[model samples]
Target: MTPVRLAFCIALALSAAPAFATDEAPPQKATNLGEVDVNARLDEARNSLSPDTGSSQYVMTRQTIQALPLGDSTPLNQVVLQAPGVVQDSYGQLHVRGDHANLQYRIDGVLIPESIGGFGQTLDTRMIDNIKLLTGALPAQYGDRTAAVVDITTRTPKDGVGGSVGITGGQFGTVNPNATLFGKKDDWSFFLTANYLKNDVGIENPTASRTAIHDHTNQVKAFGDVSYLINNDTRISFMFGATNNRFEIPNNPGQTAQFGYLDVTNFDSAQLDERQQEKTRFGVLSLQGKMGDTAYQVSAGERYSSLDFTPDDIGDLMFNGVASDVRRANRATTLQADFATPLGDSHTLRYGVYGEFERATSTNNALVFPADGDGNQTSTTPLNILDSSRILARTYALYLQDEWSIGDKWTVNYGVRADKYNAFKPESQLSPRLGVVYQPVDGTTIHAGYSRYFTPPASESISPTSIAKFVGTTNALPDNGNDTPLAERSSYYDVGISQKLGTQWTVGLDSYRRNVSRIQDEGQFGAAVVYSTFNYDQGKVKGDELTVNYDGGALTAYFNFSYNRSVGKRIITGQYNFAPDDLAYIQDHFIHLDHDQKYTSSGGISYAFPDSTRIGANYLFGSGLRRDGIVPNGDTMPAYFQLNLSVAHDFNLTSVGATHAQFALVNALDRTYQLRDGSGIGVGAPQFGPRRGVFLSLQQDF
Candidate 1:
């Protein structure tokens, strides 16, 4: 059957299912007392499904998040950058352990499907109660996109009703307003949040100037969660989220035109009016309960995302000889179940199953000038062409693992997982994982692990260009082959140790290495800021990280440093996206990936006073990303650093319940740096970092 028909059938079946709850009177206090016990048991059961046995886990609580320069207003990607082995890049992207864009996100122990690559932020920081970043060799339950795992726990209300409203605005024509409401009564609980933002610096600037030309954005996001307690041992919950964002494509002025369109020849590059729109909606429904000695939870989820790129016809034709309007959309439906049960005195068994179905579509309307064999334009008038494609794919996975405790000093976990993917082609794999944790002394811990991984390319972002149809046009390519992206298979090894120096300080060191075949990576190869995936024949990546943390009565501090090296030998897929000389050189020699940075470091310190006032500061440093030299990715850009500071205070008013205010200084040193030079393989345009700015916010809680 077709994907459309399958989706329709599933929808019908879900609608026909019987409801689990109805209108009934609130339970008594005795029942609520029993619920307290069940909630703790459920939390423990959920924690067992995702074990961080032999991985490097970094956690940030709600208090830590609020202590940052921007507080809840900081983007999720920026928050993750504070962890070890995370490198920042242009367009709000993060590379962990020398791997490009392979992170998995989970909320409340439920997986959230990946969306198409874009410049907008989908998940808001305000909804997070606590966030954890897990890296290195992982356990058996984690599959697919495994560069890192972002595990998040959402906020929940205490008891009564309460809410907050806030507004933040600053330089660069910025304004933001947000509100949140949460409450619990009897057996029903709910939380909801909404926000709107408008800013001038949406995308990175194309030059080193203080302000970017034609760069502005408007965005709106909303999320809701509701749950009902069926009894002392069972509950049902539902979650939904939505985001709509629009951005203007930034431009670089003083560029000479290379081609003419119709009667127009000279056009101002800074005045070009190009825009992009992104929208996403997702929902998940879950059922949790316990029977006998087994604990289990089942969930169903769906997500839809779309992006549209509108081009300036005359400006684009004169600049690059081609003007394209692109539209892409993807929809996914998923089902997951997990169970944990204790066998004897020394063993705990955990198993799970997952399935997903996805459909993606792409449409392109392009106008191109007629060209000769020498790639010289022969006609001033442009003609239009329509190119479109669609794909349907499915994935299934099953895993089983056991955690065994030998004694008080040692623990081991071993498991295996099988996965089958049916997309443009069919593929299957069976991977094994093993991990050991040892505690030899007081306040000292050591861990070692090895894992085999199988990763499939993102289905929503794979759209092959029709090379033959563009021949004899200005949009033609120099190469001929267009191979489909393949799955990546790899072996990973990791070792780490953590020790406590005294009562207030702790330090850790970790090292990891991976050897991969058919390794996957992504890049922006078009005028639109969308990414495409490709494969390398062989890849090797290695990294080491050092971390130190301190916590006293009223002061806190942390520092992290990482060194990474990543190289790929051959471009086995997506040949049309590379030049012949670069491909030949890479086939013979190893070259660094475009997003790889050799050294990265971040540190922060915060202090709280007795008068309910807090002062905080943070710093970030990078050795720089790769650029083009004599060969592909042979040179690096200049190093750079940034500093930020914040001050916040609480106030109690007689008329209002409570109020808070904050002031922040971003990029305090006013340093200028380039993130991309637009000269490497599959690089599209130049981009620079943000300049200095000041921001202020006020909030009222009741």
Candidate 2:
């Protein structure tokens, strides 16, 4: 059956099923007198403008997420695209403040380690209750990845037995079916959500292709959480999630064969079929309790991910004279513990320790022609080469911080952390963080902070440099021994102020600067668009962000603007990843980073009418993304703008639960824009943004 038809049938079946009755309200238990309850002292403050230490943070609740034109089917990355200082990439990868692949993810205060790179988003936003984007000069508790910290709080068990089923479909032969179930029973509670998606436009289209071929995807995802309350002061919970996805790599048509072999002359690139598959699963067990004046929580988790890429042999060999089938398997395990205590009336001390172990196995099957002295293909009989290896990566970190209050006007937070990593060599560093918040009057806050950051190389992308097999072959490149990417160490400074204009209006401004001895970024290379890690010898970044927000009972709106500049002094490692001329130019002059954009802005207005109807409109604007030119990264794509609109209606059924239907229009203007130019410095393929589309969804809740 077609995806759209299947989704329609599922929605019909759900509509026909009888709605389950809501559970009765639980009886209230009497509280003991003269007893004080203490919970975990995590910096649990939800306010983004609170007088907290360490730079700026943005928090988005479920309501805020739903208010955006991007619906519940959106992934966490799409939601983050609305934030300041974030840039959109062709592969759905996000770059924060000019830094790449440096974001850390946490769920319910437990860390989720990095997995193999693929086209699927591992974390679904439907299961999220709230998300916090912490950036700028980070606190010591935030280590490893330092560009940003994405902390996600999952939806908790509902007060009664309830569930929701929904289906969404739109242009591009898209279909999505999703469901959520949650309930509470005495001391035990559980929540679960599952989603399946099929779409014709799985990945971005080539800028010149205009149309995509062999680009379809089907994905399955599920998430679950269960908790048992041992008592009011102690609790245990288990969480697990899985994602399985398959994609057909899009093709560019009408390409003549670079080499004309016997009996095969016309090489239509569109006929070259390529595919990728990925499977990932993870689980976490956590326990939290309070003992006397101290609070503690501990968590342990393991994750496994595997990716496989298959290439079309005939087309690849005819055009590029090479084909590589690759497979990667990865496993990660983590253990973490946190403790918090109140010291006197002026200080609150918090500390944590974390340890992780990762193992990755990579295998590549490559077929290429035997080359002549001039590096020209000579043989029709393909030469077969096998490359395989396994590596272990380990990390350990410890941190301590104190939130000290001095009178009513000033607050200071200070901490230090140490991290050690074992991969290429034994590498370690110490980081210190400090932040001060001043409140001169009511509804006003000013903050300044500085941080020393140390980021270890990504475990999943690193491998020993092996240049012997392809040295004299068609896939040859000048190879040096120092090919592995290096760690990054930097110093960051930030300042910001937030003020309330009235009861419903607020505005804020923030600025930051970063100086680095080593910078890290990931880039796609080769025909497969395989990602590899590389570094800049030295660099600096500067940016500023402005935000204005207004909330009036039924009306909500926000506007944000950001300006950024990122430059690298020289190429430090993995020269094989770049073209020789571009590398030479970068070595001689300061070069703009590939993901750099001069200006980015986003704005939205949402209103809820009294008639149970809602409307929202939003827009995203960008000056341009960097591209290749006479000099490295000297050109950029044309500026582009996109507008989105959404409308929703909620109907209350007297005998059943409420039902909601929504319609959305994406890229309302249908502006055609390119995300990446094919010839850019370090860009492997060209991609264009989505065109205009109309989408609809229906859901029923009980």
TM-score each candidate. 0.94, 0.92
The global C-alpha lDDT for each of the candidates, from Candidate 1 onward, is 0.82, 0.77
Q: What's the lDDT of the predicted structure labeled candidate 2?
A: 0.77
Instruction: Give the per-residue lDDT digits (tens) of candidate 2, residues 87-133.
Output: 88887888888887688998877889877877889988899887777
Residue-wise C-alpha lDDT for candidate 1, range 258-286, written one tens digit per residue = 89887878999999999999999999998
Show model 2 residue runs off by greater than 4 Å. Answer: 1-52, 208-211, 260-263
| Candidate 1 clashes between residue pairs 3 or more apart in a chain or in different chains | none
- Clash pairs (backbone) in predicted model 2: none
